[model samples]
Target: MATKYAMLARTSRLQSVASTEELEEATTELQNFTVAAGTLIKVASEQSAPTDDLQVFVYDPVLREPNTTRKYQCAQDSLLPVSDDLWPFIVSIPEPNRRLQLVQDSSRCNWLYTAMPGDVVSVPARYFDRDDFRLFECIICYIGPVPEIHPVGYFFGLELLDDVQSPQTADISFTRKYFECDADAAIFITADRILPTPLPQDEEIESANEAPESSWSLTNFIQNTVDSIRASLPL
Candidate 1:
């Protein structure tokens, strides 16, 4: 079975989410849940371009918010592999509140991950959210290939919350911590696209203080985070 982990973010805005109550009820009905996983995960933006934008596509299956959909629209020219030539390059605003907020409130959080295939080694996270889209306003750096940029993780399943009288449900997916690439900025990565991998091995992990020039991979990040979560669980 695939291992599980808990994602904890400090967000007053997220605390009031509508899915929390529904997820509790749905978990009870599920005899076994094959937590969200797959290859359709990746963040996109239309406000700027694939190279530059102010929105992130975070595909969490348990997500139910509907208001942030408009801001996270994908650009017409952007595509699956994220062609740098076809993508636009817009300048980012020097503001933290705007950038961080973009990540805090996104409807596409479920689409930001994928299953593990060893071919591609690294990716960068870009695209911003509508709430305060200033966090991701610079270059998107990847951890694997030298010039290629990608995202933090990949998501697989998705289910919209339904109005069931017996048990409520939480249509949510999965996610990971991302690093931004701006020298002048505080954040290192943004939610750009999901990598086609689940968890990473112990050797592939990287800490927050690690140097930027090293080769980075989503598997390493996922494995490290999952390990932390597993350790915290009660017996």
Candidate 2:
């Protein structure tokens, strides 16, 4: 988020002159004191008004003057103050976000993420095959397939958060890193698998209500993932 700011001229400060009677007496030079250069300040808009003289809390901390805010007159010299553009505001412009766009499943069904990147969700099985693992929560760190790999995109690049380990670490090599994580913490997978698994707590509820069936032993997990990738492609 961009904060509103006012930039002061670096070379100058508030200029002062002697009294009106002294101004009538002196004809040549004006008396002044050296002051610090201008400061870029951030302030609460409610405390200030957009006028020629703007009141703001500048970094002008003084030894005796404890109160912080000060009012100063400013003009750009580019135009007349009455005709100048004042009180303008910045607005956010809309852009396309792929996560909001629909993704197709292995069976050509459409789906969307219930939890986005940086949020945890359970996948039926992760990238590699190891018998003891089943549904577990992994944070979705990315939303596209591995680069230069087949079926161009539509995979979740995950950062495995559980005690269970995997061979991947966002990439196979240093030059190909897709996301940052520990050396063996990442795995990329299709969106299809995230839908079928229940989170561990949800799994416990399922076990309490019904006979516990074997979640994917996934001896063929890699092959299954590959098949899903191919199935998602146009024939």
Candidate 3:
């Protein structure tokens, strides 16, 4: 379960900044949020074609100046805001809408819930299965078969509240191994809240090496990864 502290706590806060001004508003909120330890952040988005570039800048508000910002080729996709992944909570772009997209699951034959733009979603780090590489694929790639349109990309992070024992850490590492088998197929992370990035044709070799150990090829990997990740989360 997520630890929800009283808003009064000076170091426990969460907010979503949709604009520069909104980001400024997060200052006070950040003060209240006690950066939780053992946080794992999974940010996924598509990269536009090479001809088109996407720019994202991060400001260290405390300094009133920007830090070393990164610019990726339109075809490049790397984890943005590569700051500490864990936090007591999150302050992200877009906001949450109570509404969810409903889709029929052919395998399960049940309606499942998915995130719309502005949805700040969370899941336990333990819920991910590293073996099938399904978890990693879903988090990093959206090429899976699911037909539902994701209004925006997804950003997720976990804040570990208590002392995690060695077994739990082992389990997490064990889960990561399943993902290591593919090691390629364009598994990349983006900083945007919406899906605008695209995998570059030039990076094809880099991506291919990242596929999972399972029977998934690039096509299956995309559909399966997107569908699986969208389905696995608790909506």
State the lDDT of candidate 3 residue by residue for 1-235, as single tens digits: 0221111111212222244554577554322122222122222223345533233223233331223332212112222222222111122212211010101112111101232222222223333344422122133322111112122332321212233322234223322232331322212221221222235676977888776566656888699899999999999
Error of 3 at 201 (Å): 26
Instruction: Kindly list the per-residue Cα lDDT of model 1 for residues 130-189, writing each as its tens digit.
Output: 453222112222322111122222211111112211111121111122232122222222
In model 2, where is the ten-residue run with the lowest total lDDT?
Answer: 87-96
Candidate 2 lands at a TM-score of: 0.32
Q: Against the hidden reference, what TM-scores do the models get? A: 0.15, 0.32, 0.15
Clashes in predicted model 2: 0
For residue 121, what is the lDDT in candidate 2? 67
For candidate 3, give the lDDT.
Answer: 0.27
| lDDT, candidate 3, at 59 | 25
Global fold similarity of model 3 (TM-score): 0.15
Candidate 3's displacement at residue 213, Å, is 39
Model 2 lDDT per residue over 1-235, tens place? 0233433333334423344565687574553333333333323232223533333333332221112444333333211111011101000001112111211121212224244577676765533556646776678777654544332334566777788665554544431266776546666655445643335897898778774355554655788899999999999
Angstrom error of the Cα, residue 6, model 1: value is 3.2
Question: In model 1, which regions exceed 4 Å deviation?
Answer: 7-107, 114-136, 143-182, 185-187, 190-235
| 9 Cα displacement, candidate 2 (Å) | 69
Each model's lDDT comes to 0.28, 0.42, 0.27
